[model samples]
Target: MTTKNLLVELFVEELPPKALKKLGDAFASVLCEQLRTQGLASASSVATAYASPRRLAAHVTHVRSKAQDQAVLQKLMPVSVGLTADGQATPALLKKLASLGADVSDPAAAVAALKRQGQGKAEALFYDSLVKGVTLDVGLQKALDEAIRQLPIPKVMTYQLDTDCGMPHFLPGWTSVHFVRPAHGLVALHGDTVVPVKALGLTAGNATQGHRFEAAKTPVVIAHADAYAQTLRDDGAVIASFAERRGEIARQLAARAAEVGGGCRPIEDDALLDEVTALVERPNVLVCQFEPEFLEVPQECLILTMKANQKYFPLLDAQGKLTNKFLVVSNISPADPSAVIGGNERVVRPRLADAKFFFDQDRKRPLESRVLGLAKVVYHNKLGSQGERVERVSAIARAIAQQLGGEALARQADQAALLAKADLLTDMVGEFPELQGIMGGYYARHDGLGNDIAEAIEDHYKPRFAGDELPRNPVGVCVALADKLETLVGMFGIGNLPSGDKDPFALRRHALGVVRMLIEKDLPLDLGQILATSAEVFGERVFTSGPMPSETPEGSIGIGSIGVKIDPETIPKVRDFIYDRLSGSLREQGYSAQEVDAVLALRPQRLSEVARRLAAVRTFAALPEAPALAAANKRVGNILKKADAEVQPVVRPELLKEPAETALHAALEQVASVADAAWADGDYTANLKALAALKGPVDAFFDQVMVNADDPALKANRLGLLATLHQAMNRVADLSRLAA
Candidate 1:
């Protein structure tokens, strides 16, 4: 037994900073399997991997010297065939056949071997053979080779001479060995000096480089793979951990902001810095300032320009007002840092000027005037332009508003939807794609539109992503819903439905946005009605087979699903992509997946109703006796199944003879009234609590009475009472369907 260490690094041209870590993990996983399949086992902890933009590496400690030895031989010799077709064999027969691999050619001879007499007989001879074998290093090399050969690398290239390497790899030319980018080189080290990675044309060396900036002139020597990371960090310019980088950057940004009149707080921007670290080997923070007059620009514009364009962090005052200064994290500490600050300020100047131009230009036309421009913008090639889209949205929004009985808001909603996308064609939005809706609102307000309408225009695209905020007002929710539905229906109608991971039209986002409006904002909507109205408005543009089937159809049915015909009897696929995203959004607010799934199972047509029902179920489920009550519900279901077979039955309290039956009937009546009131009030939790109360009496009634009696009348009577219980139970939820 010998302890060993193995290292394999794929050094390549600067990789996609974001995809490097994931690819490294994938490479290690793929290699680990290959090694294990070759019977290379580790005596200590399992293999581990590390990755950076330029390299992917792995190490396995305490590996066995070689796979344990074992024998390999066929065990095929039918006991019946040991003797001739007869049951016995002659003494000469055994001796004559001994030349073959058989122990005995007689049935009794084999049987006699199993039962040794008091006197011992000659011991049976054994066959010799060897199992699959490999020397440790050879096995390791073969494993590495197989892994490299089978590794999945897309868009691979080779910079060297072409060779017919015995592997079907991603690279078209040069040696079979390849990397995602050109392999800058590789180092497969075993303890010390150059462990030749000749297979990949890389020679392991003690030489490695550190920071591309500060340490650009320094070459650090590393004796082993374990020390390679440390050497790079000690001599290199930065740390590898993403958390550490973010923490350090935030600390420096805060400290710089504090040095000024105000403290700088980081605005949540979807984890941009985590990805930024992969691009820079080191980070140097500097405080930069622009003309205070620039602060007049919308806070959003300022933040976006600083972050999206220049990768600068905006500073905020103690009162949370945007300040005139910004923080820039640079990879290099310049001789005159003020030069870097000047360069960034210069780059952002045009963007701010553009914003100012749009802002000033928008003041003259007002949103009302721009509505005409959206028509020429073309919302869709088949359906129409943004102008046409605006009209359709107006119609759909008005219809939804009328449905919601918001006559005034409905009129405003229609107006908002029509004007929402108009901003897309405006100078401000044209310059900054992110300000589409906000600019529309800004223009509307400048045009003297009512605050409600302006807000609706701005809010139509609320909750742009999962966990993002929803529209602040109900009118905004209605208009936003109408706006998103119009796009989804129009695109889906035109055969431009999302295929695979490709959603060119952003329809899925629109759908999820719609779902969120319903669930989070308590907007009551019927998805089918919304989709139908949108489709009708768009006419020929709608292109789906139907509303994506809520459930797979009966046997051998052919309906397209994710680019393939769904199988008959396929369990209703819960469009998990949508639900998972929804669940994640809800989970962040402290909702559990099971609770969300339970509500989703009811196929809530309105997101608001789903939230209400989820709240109720979660509350009811917390009761200690909830499981027992659910069991009672199941029993009521069983009785109703039999009760349905007979003529229509009704609960007639006058005919009740048993006290248990009478009590159960009375309980149902009381619960029904309360449940109906709760449902009307949109208080599903109260309804669930009311229903749970029936469980105790339901159990007592079933115990004391027979559902099927000798007398047909009594059986039917009992069954009918249970049916009433079932009807009551169904109001809250089909508890039987929920997982315990």
Candidate 2:
């Protein structure tokens, strides 16, 4: 029952930087989980993962040297099959016992000891046995192999090892192994003893190499399981923990940026920080600078090139503008660091020069001229060329703008939509697709287009993700909405709807963008009308022509009309998709399921009014009479649903015989007038609250009246009164959904 911490390490060539963190977490979690499943570790055992450029390791505390033995009961088979009519063991029963490693010499005794348990319609025989515990060496070997197999490797390389000395089936020097990278060493220790585990053709040992060029000792010897981290740090001259290395780099970046003065700091990017941490064991942040003239180019282009091509953090001023100086994380530190700084600066100069060249070359020709080039770029096989998509988007944008404003806004939006995709042909955007809309704005400005058009071109792709900013100007809003609507209607029309987690066309994002624009911007436009207009713009292109007889050859031009006419029935499907996204989004914002269901049940055409109605529903639900009213509303709905014919909402005063029925009819008449006025004025909360005065009359009518009376005329009159009450209460939302 004695326990000690266990340590395991795999030393290999440098791993993929972006996948290193996930790889480390997966390895440690799976190893500890396997041990716990086998009963070698308790629920309280902790696992710590360590990952560096050349290593992946884990240390687990409270792992037992051996698991405890326990009794296991396993159902074998039905009693009818395991026993003969005379109550003797059959050949099949004996064979099953043999497979379980049970003693078959005394089959009759074993069968006698078996217990019967009911399973469905039949009784089954069960076998009980004491399972032996697994030793540390064997358990650790299995866990180690499983951990390596599940490392989340992005890509695998096949290589041959120098020797396969301990491998069971392969000859020495000829065996091949596949891994993220070539494995050179592995270390596994239980306390001070080496656990005999093998992986990637290497036998586990108690020693590993560190920091190829900076380790104090060539082979850092881990004395015991608990000493693994400290020994590696002291002798290896490396920070093995990924988080610790990242923190050190961040501290150094801050210190160096402060030394430069003028409120300068390293640009904030978590992904860049993680990649830098994965690239070095010993981080030395050094400040480097390039010629200040490069600043004339757009800072976005320069910043993106530095971070993507060189993995360097570009410095920025207090005003959030890029500065000339940048920070580079070196893998080693020297007494005089000028050489490393100069080398990094020298390497970055060419990358900056290339970005400047692309920007300059892109500006020579106006963005408007590139519109013709997009015809060669395929947007999708079924959707035809980007040129065709641009035409559809431009038409939709103008229609939306005309509805929102007048001729001026419509003209600006149309021009912006026409030029938005033109940037795809520019040298700058060709090099970096992330800079497409951004570069369009710059190039349009350079071409002497007004600020409205330039800004619209840039902001049309705004709110690309959740919580991202919306377009800043009205023209931009029109184009953004049009762009998203075009995608949604076109895809859904062609039967390309998103299936669980598999939206290749990003239809869900497009739908959410439309919802945000309509609801958050309060655009006062009808979603169904917009979808219909966009579908018309697509015309015959929305239909699928089955599969293409053959794909257009690469670099081929003028591949004529591939799409047929669209199915008109898809318009409602597209509208419903947008509403589904809205429902999910509102629920995620902290509304209860019942509240959301009630508000969304109406499927209001004006999305901007939804929030008002939901607020009104919430306010009404808080009233003292809400439960009784909600229950009465539910009862009324069920009563109307069971009627043989459609019940009219007209209640004749002469037919109201019961005092309770007459009282309820009078109360509804008085309340409905007030609620109707509030609803007409868009005071939804006041309207729903005004209906709360009918709770007493509603409850009393339901308590004293028999809705299904013997006389058909009386029954119809009662149904009419209930229908009138149902309509008044459910104007804002379906209150019955709020009932428990």
Candidate 3:
């Protein structure tokens, strides 16, 4: 087959910068996949995606001009239905052959040529045919149409295109088209020839426009399919590759920051970098400055305003502190860049000033004063106001702190929890919801609250996502755990559980956060106790009588109550939910599923012990006796479960008439004492490894003894012996779960 590289481009109005990269990648990948599926492109063909502010293009190598013809064998029908008793073609078979473009003039010959294949109860007739290959023109048209239909466009625009009245294809003055943006041009080339594909109300050509203001030529002509990128760069003054443009911008930013030479560097934010790259065709990094007085506000406020509103990167000093200087990425380059720098600086001043104003107004009253205002803000219709939620959180925090520390730490956590949500009523937080906890911390310091309380307020929302930092101080840990537990218990109590991917309340994240804090912080708190305390704090709120409130009334601030009751069964569900999240998290951390299941089956209350237990199980699994012991444990569990009466681990030595039972009993006594002692001292690894010595005795007892003997006393004695073995092996984890 003759092959050549293929090129396709779509020029449009400026696209959404955040979605541009994804759209470009999807367009190229989908188009290439479609061609490969149709056998027009080989499996080894490579695809390169090109994206700029105004264009999306793809170049695929080794695409054939036409797909090869194929031979197809299709089953027609059963022999009984397709032919008469004498094997002559029936009218039905002749009509089917006519629809398939087969010559029906000689029906007998056609019937004789049909192959016989066996069906379930009878024989079936098969027909063979040749399928013609699809030409490049038709195949490209289908590929282009389907690619355009599947772009991951954030939103669609509807516009009309001007029509050429003299053209035969025109029906009226204008034609309506819906696309990501208004399509102005499309280019499709195979080797050096135009492929003549049409899409989005435009005919394919070999020319496309370049940078709107900086292009060296208008309607740059692409010479060949392989020359698209080079042609655009040389004649159109456009980089034409999204990744290349991003790399160029990063290089310029680094160079300019180094030239400034005060240990200065651009603040690192990939999302901001990507957005800026999508907004420019040719990036020119320039330095701009703001008034130093604005730095009096929190650096977070200033940096966010610059990056979010003006799309600029704020410079940072050696100490990771924001400076008044910032970097701007402009699309056009000029001999003297003073005009661009001044324009960006002027545009950014007002945004920074707004942030400063909000900060100033927010500090006028202390965070403590904002507490009353939260009463007017509804948190949830079923859960009451933010003020009520604060109260519940405060109670839970204090309870946890008292258990972990003394009264002093308890007081600090209680105070922090009380004011944590007060910032939601602040002007700064109201303007930027992302700064809620941060603003609360600042306001607390302004009100002369101690650093302990202020830091706790700031750190209460620690670990907002996976791998995020945890609370820095003990007080913060208490409050964070309490806040998360309250949400889990209260939501589960009201039956608002997450189903499938619908986790509107983010209960999964909250549960994971709680698990991380407990395990990583090495806190000795029991998960079940924390859940019960959190549920008690909710009191009658979980039992409010009505359908769960999905939305709050517009313009109404007072807390509303749902009239429903909390079911007693909801507590166990909440516990199971937490355990499920813990299990998944452990697996993601590199533990195998069997190891995790064995440890979690015990449902250990102290999450701090889970990691140690898992480690112990991993060590035990490598032992030579692990398999046999695990199997024996599984057998013992089954026998005890099936026993008619309740079987206890206590065994009477005199009832052990069998020698194997007596030997197993002696081994269990020695091993259980040693393992139990190690477990009490927290040496879980050593505790589990001690059970390896029981493999020999356990196998012998199971092989020689009948647990369901006709004599009730003997059977009970055997069950007790097995029960003792089961208890000894499962101190760290359920060994049965490790069995194959």
Q: Pick the candidate with the highest lDDT.
A: 2
| Candidate 3, RMSD to the unseen true structure | 2.8
Worst 10 residues of 2 by lDDT: 542-551
- The segments of candidate 2 whose C-alpha lies over 4 angstroms from its true place after superposition are 73-128, 164-168, 541-560, 644-648, 706-717
User: If both were scored by lDDT, which would come out higher, candidate 2 or candidate 3?
Assistant: 2
Pairs that collide in candidate 3 are: 543-564, 543-565, 544-562, 544-563, 544-564, 545-562, 545-563, 545-564, 546-563
Give me the displacement of residue 331 in model 2, in angstroms: 0.8
Candidate 2 structure quality by residue, lDDT tens digits, 1-740: 88998999999999999999999999999999999988888899999999999999999999998999999999998988989989899999999998998888987888888888997549999999889999888898888888888778898899887664567677766788889999989999888989888888888999998888889998999999899878888999889899899999999999999999899999999999999999999899999999999999999999999999999999999999999999999998899999999999999999899999998898889988989877767777678678888999999999999999989899989999999999999888889999989999999999999888888899998788999888888999999999999888878866899999999988888889888988899989988888889988977544222323234455654335455455788888988898899999999998888888898887888798889888988998999989888988898999999999998898889999999999999999999999999989999999989888999898889889999999999999999999999999998999999998
Model 1, span 533-565: residue lDDT tens: 766675433322322222336554423322222
Model 1 clashing-pair count: 14
Tell me which of candidates 1 and 3 scores higher on lDDT. 3
Query: Sorted by lDDT, highest first, which candidate order results?
Result: 2, 3, 1
**lDDT score, candidate 3:** 0.88
What is the RMSD of candidate 1? 8.8
Q: Looking at candidate 3, what is the lDDT of residue 571?
A: 78
